[model samples]
Each structure stands twice: as structure tokens, then as C-alpha cells.
Target: MATTSGGDLSHFAISSVYGELLSEMSILTAVETGLLEFVCCLADGLAPQAKGHFFGSRNLGASGDTMRATIVLVDDISRQLGVGFSWKNENFAFLEKVAAW
Candidate 1:
């Protein structure tokens, strides 16, 4: 067997998770529609280079459609916890908010 590099293993892990999430999607119109909206919202926040399968941001709007599943999970937890979620650009103000939190 060929030896796998650390980079290769990392990519394999990420792809596995992504596939698992996508495989669980149903054909329900409401669910699919919501997922699509989430995908677009996350994509809007990602940098072009981060929108890849591997070696980039694993957060919303980074990977293709994967962000939808991720956002759904995050939304569930945040809503249950009664906390708000927001995204801001990589600016000092955003950093300050994070630090304050």
C-alpha cells in the first residue's frame, strides 16, 4: 500500500465528513430550499480560494454546499441556546468583538 502523507489524511477526513453530511440530505422541498439558501449565505462570506474541497476554511461559505449542512447544525445549537450569530469581515472591530466574547 502507498504511504499517505499528513496532508492526504487531512483531506480524506474532511471529504469523508462532507460526503456523510450530503448523503443525509432528503428531497423535501422545504429542507432542500433552506439548505440552498444557507449555502449561498455561507458562500457570500468565504474568500474565493477557501471555496475548495480541502486545505481551506471549513466554516460556512468556504466549501461547496457543505456549508449548508454546517450552518444548519450551527443554527440548531445557537437557537436552542438562545444566542445570536453574526459574521463580520476580518477587521479590527470583528477581532474586538470576538475578544470581548
Candidate 2:
């Protein structure tokens, strides 16, 4: 995985967006927000980051419903984008159980 300093523009941009979304929107909890970010990372083909956020969400207490929704949304987005990747490994067993398909 690539590393970036706190001052990096991309890091700043992501932090800014999440800050605003979390503070202003005030709808999703931290775990849900992390899952949403995981989806974005997956969409961008950043598998390491996606994995980090997915597990981070779980660590932060993501519920089964939220995990299922995340899996379904990821499947929908991946299909729509013609993107292919595997999340069926042991590390993702928890997610695989709740996958919509």
C-alpha cells in the first residue's frame, strides 16, 4: 500500500468530504460512514484501502444489516462498472455470508 502524509491533497480532500458528510448530514453512524467509504475505495480499485475500511467498520460496530447493504451496494456498483474482483477469501467470510447474491 502507498503511504501519504497528513498534508497530502488527496488525504485532505477525503478527510474534508467525510468531515462535512458526517457532521452536516448527521444520518449515518461512524460504522456506516466507514462502509460507504469502503465502497468508494472498492470502486476506485483500492483494494487495500477497501479492506481497511471494511474491517474498520466492523471494528466500529457495524450491524449485520449495514454489512448486507454494503455487500449489495458493492455488488451492484461492481456489476454496473464491469469491475471484477474476489472477496471470497477467508478474510471476507463474514461479508460473504450476507452477500445479496
Candidate 3:
């Protein structure tokens, strides 16, 4: 682990009940396209370091047809009342794939 006064690495999270979601993908995309490979994760989507991740402002272009990983921390699912469906509160640690393996 590394320690700095104001270190580098992105953090934050978003919770949604359904579907695939990311709060801000542009930054993640930048990290993915940049020099990084993987990211560390937390139980609730909060993170410390992102190998192929970024923590600050960056100018990025378009990203098309890339692999993305969403690291989920919490998934609270409940059945819809009297319905045949369910609801969920989910959070994820997002990772953008910059290269192929």
C-alpha cells in the first residue's frame, strides 16, 4: 500500500434498483484508456486504488466496444409487494478495460 498527503485514486459510488449503472463513466473511461490495469475494491463500492483507474480531471475522447467491469459491493434485493418482481439497491466499483488479454 502507498500513502501520500493527497494521494491519487478515484472514489465514490451510486446505488440503483435495476439495470447497469455508473455515476460517471467518462473518468473511468479515461483511466481505462490510460496506463492502468486493475482496481482495488471495497464492500460498498468505495475504493482506495484503481490500477487502470483515475482520480482527477482528464481530457478523453470517445470509447467504443470495450470491456467494462462493475465491482458490486452491496446488493439488497426485495420482492415487490404482491408482484412477481423484485427491487434492489446496488453499488459497484467500476473498471474499464484498456487492453485485451
lDDT of 2 by residue, 1-101 (tens): 02555467666556776556554536876766787787787666666777777777777787768877777777787888777756545545545544442
- Which candidate has the highest TM-score of all? 2
lDDT of 3 by residue, 1-101 (tens): 02442322212121341112433455665444332322222222233333223232122332322222222211211122232221112322223222331
Taken over the whole model, the C-alpha lDDT of each candidate is 0.42, 0.67, 0.28
Query: Could you say which candidate leads in lDDT?
Result: 2
Going through the candidates in the order shown, the clash numbers are: 2, 0, 2
Judge candidate 1 at residue 94 and give its lDDT. 24
Cα displacement (Å) at residue 91, model 3: 6.9
Worst 10 residues of 1 by lDDT: 92-101
The TM-score of predicted model 1 comes to 0.26
Worst 10 residues of 2 by lDDT: 92-101
Over 4 Å off, model 3: 1-46, 51-59, 62-64, 67-91, 95-101
Put down candidate 1 lDDT per residue, 1-101, tens digits, no spaces.
12567487667655774455544556633345444544444434443322232222233224444444455665566668665544335521322222222
Model 1 residue-pair collision total: 2
